[model samples]
Target: MSVPALNRAPDAVTTRVTAPGSRRRPDIEGLRAVAALLIAVYHIWFGTVSGGVDVFLLLTGFLITGSLVRAMERDGRVDLAAFWTKLVKRLFPAGAVVLGAVLLMAYAYFPRSQWTTVIDDVWAAALYYGNWHLALGSVDYMAENSAASPVQHFWSLAVQGQFYLLWPLLVCGAALLAVRLGRSARRGAAVAVGTVFAVSFGYSLWITATAPVWAYFDTGARLWELALGGLLALFVHRVDLPGWARTVAGWAGLAALVLCGLVIGDSLPYPGYASLWPTLAALLIILAGAGTAANGRLSANRLLGARPLTWLGGHAYTLFLWHWPVLVLHLELTGLERPTPGGGLLVLGVSFAAALATSWMVDGGVSRATRRLRTPAWSLAAGVLFVVPVLVAGSLWAQSIERDRQLRTELSSNPLAYPGAAVHLDQDLARNLPSLPVYPDTTTVARDTIDQTRACNALIDQTEVVTCEFGDPRSDYTIALVGSSHVRHWFQALETLADQHGWRLVTMTKNACQFSSGEQRYRGEVFTECAQWNDGVMAALDELEPDTVFTLASLTSVRSGPEEHVPEGFVERWRQLDARGIDVVAVRDTPRFSFRVPDCTDRNHRSECSEPASHSMAERAPYLELDDVPANTRFLDMTGYLCQDDVCHGVIGNQLVYYDTNHFSYSFSQSLAAVMEPYLLEAAGRAPEAELTLAEAALSPEEAAEAAREHDGSS
Candidate 1:
């Protein structure tokens, strides 16, 4: 599920009870405060910043593992039954409170369709399986521009819960092995800590280098951070250092911690070397806090030891529990990416206030109530009371699955009815297209490449890649349009007019086709799919010797100001194509939608679906020239076909021209054939309208085969 290292160390040990009046570790509490604040800021402002969570993981692994190991030494043996019960008691109450509230908020804020996904997540969360679900789905948690699941944040919580389950067992086993070997308790603990740290860190570094995405979210890759913490605890008593050195270390550590949250933005691979800054800082603070009173002056400073911060620090566990759910629910209710600055402060204030109330009320009440639950009946009741509401809320959310599917079907049939909704564009064309137009058989010339005219049927099924041939193969004219969904959208119209003229349209486009010259960011890492696909397309184009290559204007053009640079790779690739004697036609992008495609049809009146939005053609003006290239490359502004007046309507001329957000419908494409016929003739330098006989117009593929069969029968 969570990468194994990121998961709980799957070991169990009894909870440890520290002696009364143990020397106060003010710095550790301060560290906790810092970790909590980093998480809050990152969640509120730069939710993209995940290093904060890494720091938290290090601290959690260190603290809990340390406690469990210490308890194992004192108790002589680790009690698995007591260990699990205590873990449940500590973890489940706070988790249940947060998840229960999140489920309620999801129901209140989300539409029926949105709630189904949320419900599915809630059920996963209840069972501590969120990491498995999210990883399998390849969900991008940092995508603020997209819709979110209410329980999305719970993936981290699930990881921690899994860690708790395993760390204790590992500790117990290590302690037992050491006792058997006649080793001192401290020596045994040290060996256990060192062994785990070495193995886990080695694994983490490799995972961080090789599979950074999995390393980021998976528990296995991250266990080293926790192992580091556990190891630190074993040596806490043995480390002998000067007071000045400890003070210096404490201050330096705090400074390093602050810099990590501030300096580490979204650019770096997280939970890797980037995480070392905060983790090492956390280690320093923990070490500094444990030294004698001489070194404790700064480590146990009056400011850090102050009532309010330490009080929040005391309730940090509870605060972490309540804060995220509250903020998530608040955001859901408002539909804001995150709370505004003022709103963030309000969320912080309200969350802490709620945390305090829950800490005093539910957390304290549950702890007290469960103390009497030593008997099976009372224990069962306590467990059921805690778990049933979460289960039921989760189950209710689950039932919306069928409801969501049915709604999606109805919405796809009529997009105008659902506002702020998105329907699968490929499915729409497959379900709706009535029939294909018939044309006279073109002569089969020895063509090495596909023709554009015959690419119509090929474009319909988008999931699979297909090859087609269009014009007389021997002709010198061949044009290839290569791109992502953006290029595919224009194919229907291009194919229609291609058949009318003799130009072959060689189709080679893929979803998310980034014609990159070098490394590029995609799906949270440097990806090469687009680059590899581009290489293939370029090779095919060179071999075919296409007369012209059509490419989309930069996606950056859609959002950037007129002066903004087009994506460098796109421009460079086109230039490369131009150098090969291919005329480059840079087609400006079509109007993109502000809302989901189905928002136009969503029955809910809360969404904006009435009119499509438009931007200036000036946005595309910069890269249109391509005159610097060797071959003659032209800029075509076909925005006019999709736009009207000042605005681009999703529907054009009373026709649902766009089946979804920006993609033109095939029906719309068929109509545009008339308007584009002139351009096609001009581009190919040929004009030959196909003259279809009545028999040819009416003849089906089956009938043609039948006619051949009849002639054969007569013969």
Candidate 2:
């Protein structure tokens, strides 16, 4: 094998006599084939190749850097503009082709609603900000059942681009220092390479221990592989090896990489200590081809140096670009995972065909067409123009997805309606938490719960001050609504009745706040806010004993574990309220889902969203019971509003009862006025006391009509 004789070209190069000592290496191409195949297998079956992509990254850094270093040494100086020009020629055409194809697929197969998100992703990929955007989106690439994201493969490209930006200056600096320091040029280069390897390896080790994801994504932590190659390039000419040794090392290196997918598989943690195996394997192969394999017949035997593999190698960059987007879009459209065994094989076949064809058109056709233009600036501009729109479109699409999501949140303030609602909503009690989407903001404006305490002596014509005031004290009974967001939903119905009954409703509930006195983690901290607020409410109740205490107790026992029935330490808490001469009654919580059932919208799939039947509610009795409470505490189950016959449907009375997976809509609750009045009377011990019919207390035609009008206007 022989290297091409040193020569300079302003913009174009003519063929020169081959150097006597230089050679072309077949083992390097075989190694590349092995890396690509491993990455493909891992993305396909995953059980076969786990950390194989890191091997490819290491090889990319090594091979590309090795070529640049050799050119720089011969030229005696680095040409920044020329270097960048060559890179743009090498990378952009294939990337642009893949991006354009992805956009076309998005238009055909994706829902119109997803267009915004996909557009933003396109723009991000074009700008090389895809990895940062993914990080902010909290995307986990290693998850088992993720939706097919088009730019997930770009994280590796981002890492590579970071290296490309920094490596040339480092290499040129090392070359210049060698000339200036009066040291052997090769030795100076070795020192620079050694420094990079030592520092990068150390950083890699540190990040692997503390931040493996960052380590895997960052270029700095991965520079050691390229450094190892650069160092090898300078010193390999000095070593002498027997033919058997060369063959064994070369074959062994190739075999190690080929068998890597089978040995390591996809379950490995990735780019951590485990990556050293393949990186070292790639290193060995590159080193084996250093001295005797330039370009001669003996150096490049036909079997190892076949034109097919070489041509594939030539289109490797383009093939890599096309394969992932093809596989991703195929999966997105089919949702078949891969055509497993038969299906997977078919998908692989189609993917390979598309990749090769696109590679030929984009890499070969585009490169050849652009090569004769002669002007570096114009060629570079053409490449940038092709790549930029696709990238901008991807970025814009992602932003649009976010915007659509925001609009959804604004339309329905229900926590469950918005994907990231939990993080954005404020939970304070003074803010009209009774409204739909506005659950009880538990933290009172009067931060000290005791300061907000008051009595309802003005409206209630009763002996005991059972009601406690919190927000406004001007209304009739000064009724205090207590419990969690579940309790707050009832306030919409309660507020209507409260106004009619001349009772001022005071909300004292928080999201997930149980009546039972217990400590629980909320918003990443142990929250005693609910319990503390409850204590303050009870104290206020003692001070402002109104006509009666209207409290909504959540059905907490259903979600309890076998060993932990009700929340511990909270059972005695409610009893203390009862002992203080205040009535403590609980309304069971509505059912929550393990998955989102969006068809439960007000009118969509109404039949399927009907309340549960009588029989199904009875079957769920074990989960519905309030058996853990003291006898003095009364339990009111509102399950009837959400149940019909034997099954619980997602809606009631032409309204989306459960605004989210759980929690009733205000409109739905108003419709349940008839259902709730009887239960409220029974729980308040007034149904039998007054011997009144449930219909008398329920909402009549006039009230229902007015409420319906209000809902219509709001909607």
Candidate 3:
């Protein structure tokens, strides 16, 4: 959303003046309206980049910088205090109202599991750092599937607010320097702003190429768009384009703006050279209005300054704030990933009504009431007084959720009460159900499956193999755990066996990087790091000469439905390890869900929170064929423990089964240690050949018959 940079002084001249080099341009207001509408439509229905935000950034630079320069020219000094006072009074009221509304809705409608995230987003948006928060989230693989925050649109507003705070200081400094040098203030400011544009644009191109996700929200990468507007402000007045030339340029720019969304999808890296299209288009439209009559022949201004468009433009800031949250809430409530046509229309209608009312009641009303507070200190105090409580409340809400989550984890740590998956299969299903208040509450689930706290898992971007050892380091029997997070999550189960058997356990894992010879893709980029890390892992394994290697056998292809198979490259790695006399134990991958399991269980009963085993399982026929692998290689399937009777429940044996959609909860994995120990020992050729103990022996025929009769009668 763009900050409305139109002059807001009650006594200022109407923005419709057509005088030569006039301060007001009605076309800019219409451009703001157009940009706001484009962004709303793209977000709600098209799901593409409209380049509307770039248009807003350019407009913000042109309008705000132009106003400051004119003030310096007329008064011989910029009124920084008055400028900030007016800006704050104009912007903060509407933003604060929206933030408060979003917080209320989050508490009332969203699941408590998401409360901490919502509160943190609110805090970030309120303090104008929401963009950075989102930028960090984009890079974190763990946060990849998180639902979009309702206030995510606030990132653009944060960028604008940051610029509002910094741009004026730069302009004032440049003006002062110009006065000392006997040069025009506007020219000196242009030179300074131009340098910022050039440097920032260069950085934007490089960063967008290397790290597009971060570049999308980075202020430094975005500064060039605003700087382009500032440069236009400085020079537009000096341009003497002929009427024909202005008309041609205006239409060309308008055509480009209208087609931007269709031509440039969100899949393309943004704010790089691609951003120049919209910013340059906006500049053309603004320049075309310089000398045109309101209804002149071939005039872009006449078309842009129409009554309906200007009305929408006047309320653009409020529209930008209200539309996104409404759209997000609509999707959540209706359970539609994309809006239906009827729902889309309803969202737009509601957003328009809200924007219209808020623009008048909060934005316009606050500005008028606060106009009497002429001193900057008084204005600052009023703004702080209005905003600080909301910020504090948001921060406190996040802290409170964290505290409650920590308390739950502490209270639920009873080993006897929560023996996890360690209990006998029959006893677990019959008596040792999941505990109350669930282990790994929503606030902790994201981190609950992680073994990196012990420094066993490699960082996502690192190619070097980092090993963390557990159990007896000097043990002759060595078992190396290798591959991606899927392999690492199993370490919690294996650690117990390693200790009991006096085996040295070595873990080498990289985030989401499987040990396959095939190419890997992470966040849509070719993952060269995975390939490099695999090379290091092979060398390390060769040197260590581990007796056994444990890793994932198959991965389910989400896009291909229930299909699962070993990647060709995985077979290559397995053969290499087999040649080195390292026996391989490949465990079947766990069933994955489309939604977060803890969240599902929190919202629904255990019986209601299950998926069909048939759908969740990879096509098993291929895995069964792996029986013909090298003599040293063995495959294990433990799906029966995770799923029963063609259905897989999210919670098993009174314990949460997964920390997220796929990874096992640490406690649940620990529980599985008992079930896994025998297989691991067998794989290592160390299973004891002793007669079974009474408790461990299979039931005799008469006893089994009696148990079956009892179960039938109970059912």
Candidate 4:
């Protein structure tokens, strides 16, 4: 629920008495109750979009805009300070209480690794920019699999809060312009709002098509819904439809609102043309009920004005605020992806109980205090009282993050502290290793893999091939590290070889984008950027005429099931590169896990976190096809370093293996430099020199002897 709209309803009841032609519509309150219930039910049980949020957005625009216009029409000017003060008093207290509770719950129940995200979200929601934060997160693949934050629902509230702040200023400007131009203030306001609606709607359509994931939480994409509501508010007072027309419109709109969720699944792109169904339906219901008597007739208002709904509506804001966090926390605690019917009902019951207590105790107290205080200064003070605690908590969390960074920096400086995957290869060294919390710690694990020195990985949205040169830049033997981050992570091992073998190493990479010749799908959208980037990469490769192009040969498809296959595009790209006399060295992609390895290892034992290596490597056979393609093509599998006989470990040799779910931790990958050097040399047709083997390179004779002694004792 939009806190301002729901919280202001009681004030509107008193204020409406002085305004002409204004009567309290219990039906709108009832509708709010229905919207809130639908949102809660869909989120907790169905795990789908219910169009309830769109209804709230529409109601927010309609009610707030209507109230502002009525004030302007009666007083001829808007008292912006008084308006803002009232809003702060109405909204802040309940929001602040919820934020404080959520923060405490998070710190107590959530993993330390997730504390930063929760704190960041707390700050964003407090500042009314949570929508942008969520929008950015939606496009990030790494964050896509993260457990839903308890405050994720606050994105809508943030949107509403922003609209609340900006709409009054807009209405005030329109009112002034109308006086200067000798025009109707309401009409001028309608025109201005309509213009904004058009521009926002156009942008929404474009963005939804191009980047629907981001569009889902974008404030710009959502403004049209709010503007539509404002337009209805401006005109509803002037319209006087007959009872029969109202009956038809009311029933149809009610039906549309009820079926919208079932008909338009949550998976579908929304707030574009798809949103018109719900927003327009809501507008119809509001317009149809206007000026209608609430007698026991067949009118929509009469049906909606039932006492129960209005009671729920009275507590809608609190219910909306409390339900999401309750649901998310419940799921996190229970380890259930979704609750059963009984569990969902229990969750809803608890949420409603909490909402009632907060609504009466917290919101009721704030409302009463605001009435007694009345002054802007007291309201400002009340706002500060609400906001200060959350800011203080956020500051403490930020400091903790800085401290973790410092610890990680200190630990990282000692090479012996994190020998990474090398410990698995040398059992002696493994036996002699000191105890340490997995290097890269949960705070830094997300970025533990891949090179940081090079700005060569193009973002998911970019179509350019970012290139960076490493290792023997002037050498005659050129080996281009090309593909997505999977290939980029191998640069640690390959860079070691390049330095040892005198080869020029060039990196061509894009984030989550594989070097495919055909179109690919990313986050359910056509990866036009990836395809375009590949074209650029191919052209660059031709120009550079690199001796060998190292990229991913095969990947496991998570879309359909756990089937491994050589992507048609990868095969096609390989053939093209081979035709250009570029040796295609395809490194088999690593095993991907269903859960985050670092988080799993942090919470559970290594045995509990391990998965069947065979199941993960079921797709390994597809890489064998690379042998049939051409003489220039070479296939390399490094799974031996990553997995054991039957199981794959989250931690190897006292170092965290995977950073997230699939990507290797940088330290782990660096540990594999010795193991991977021989294969890399053979792939590039270079023989190993008189340098030590992987074990010999990393372990001295004394340390090796001590490790052997420990291993013998353990045996």
- TM-score, candidate 4, is 0.91
Each model's lDDT comes to: 0.56, 0.52, 0.75, 0.76
Question: What TM-score do all the candidates reach, one by one?
Answer: 0.68, 0.61, 0.89, 0.91
lDDT of 4 by residue, 312-416 (tens): 787888899999999988887887899999989989999999888888866667666666776778877776688889889878877987797678768866766
What does the lDDT come to for candidate 1?
0.56
Q: Rank by lDDT, descending?
A: 4, 3, 1, 2
Candidate 1 TM-score over all chains jointly: 0.68
Native-structure RMSD, model 3: 4.4
Cα lDDT of model 1 by residue, 1-715, tens digit: 0110111111112122111114545445555666777677777766656355666677676666666565666667655555555555555666677677777776665544345456667777777888777654442221122345656766776787677777767777777788889886656766777787788777778876765656666776677787787777676766656787677777887777767766877667666777788888777766665655544544533345556665656566656666676777677566677788888887788778877776676546876776766643544455457667888867765665445545544544442332111111122322232321110000111010123223422221123434456556665677776766566666766776566566678777765554446555555555555566667677777788888776776553244444333576876776787678677766666666654333243323311233433342443445655455444555665554444333454443223445444555544555555455545555555544452132123323243334323432443
Candidate 2 per-residue C-alpha lDDT over 1-715 given as tens digits, one digit per residue, 9 for 90 to 100 = 1222111111011122111125545545544555666666667665344444655565555444455556656766666666566556556666677777778787777644235445656666666667666554432211111234676677666666666677767767776787788765456666777898899888878866554545566666767766665665556666545555556665676667767767766445445566777777766655555555342333322334566765555444545565676677666656555646765566567767776786677546876677676455865775687787776666565566456545543654553332111111122211222223221111111111112222222111111223433434575445556655556566656665555545566665544555556665543455555546556666766766643455544342323322213444445656776676656555555665332222233223344444333312234443245556665566666553354234455533333455444555544554454456555556555567453565454444344334433533445
Q: What's the lDDT of the predicted structure labeled candidate 2? A: 0.52
Candidate 4's C-alpha runs over 4 A off are 1-21, 292-296, 447-455, 471-477, 495-504, 523-526, 558-562, 619-621, 625-627, 685-687, 695-715
Candidate 2 segments whose C-alpha is farther than 4 A from its true place = 1-21, 47-49, 139-146, 184-186, 213-215, 238-240, 293-304, 392-715
Better of 2 and 4 by lDDT: 4
